[model samples]
Target: MFAFVMRRLAVAIPTLLLLIVFSFILMHLAPGGPFSLERELPPQVLANLNAKYGLDDPLWLQIWNYLTGIVLHFDFGPSFVYPDRSVNDLIAAGFPVTLTYGTLRARFKTR
Candidate 1:
């Protein structure tokens, strides 16, 4: 059991890391950014905003910062579209609804 658990952990860690890396890449590659829906601000204001969020850093550095935040703090960081709420907060808030929906679907399917 110990050896089996250890082997699973070894496989799981790399799979999780790859999933994170791919998701990050896909997110960045998609058109539009967090501020895209907002009204145009001055260039100085935009630059300042980017700098404050470390969005101005090189992509690799930004990815490193994000990964460090996740690994060290269990933080997925703030929502890009909802600046006031962190990703964790949003997930917590939505989980109940998700659970309910899944439960109902399964119940109906089995009926």
Candidate 2:
């Protein structure tokens, strides 16, 4: 059973890495960026925003940095939509509500 679990994990780890890389590539390939708006921002402001988020880096470098951050620190980085909060913060904030709903559903289902 241990060996079976190890074998499954070996396959699953690479599969998950591929999934993350592909998703990152696909998101970068899409047209408009997070800073895109109906009213055009000045070039200096746009450049500053890109620099702040490391968006000015090459795609490969960005991917390397992101992967390293996740692997080394287990961080999902910041939230693009909510600049003041991080991805982890958003998840943490919503987790309690999710847990409450799940617990209630499971309790009711078993009755």
- Cα lDDT of candidate 1 equals 0.88
The CA lDDT at 32 in model 2 is 87
Cα deviation at 33, candidate 2, in Å, is: 0.2
Candidate 2 per-residue lDDT, tens place, 6-77, comes to 999999989988999999999999998888857788899999999999999999999999998888888889
Model 1 clash pairs? none
Clash counts per candidate, in order, are 0, 0
| Candidate 2 clashing pairs, residues 3+ apart or interchain | none
What does the lDDT read for residue 2 in candidate 2? 100
Q: Which of the numbered candidates is closest to the native, going by highest TM-score? A: 2
The local distance difference test score of each candidate is: 0.88, 0.92
Per-model TM against the reference: 0.78, 0.86
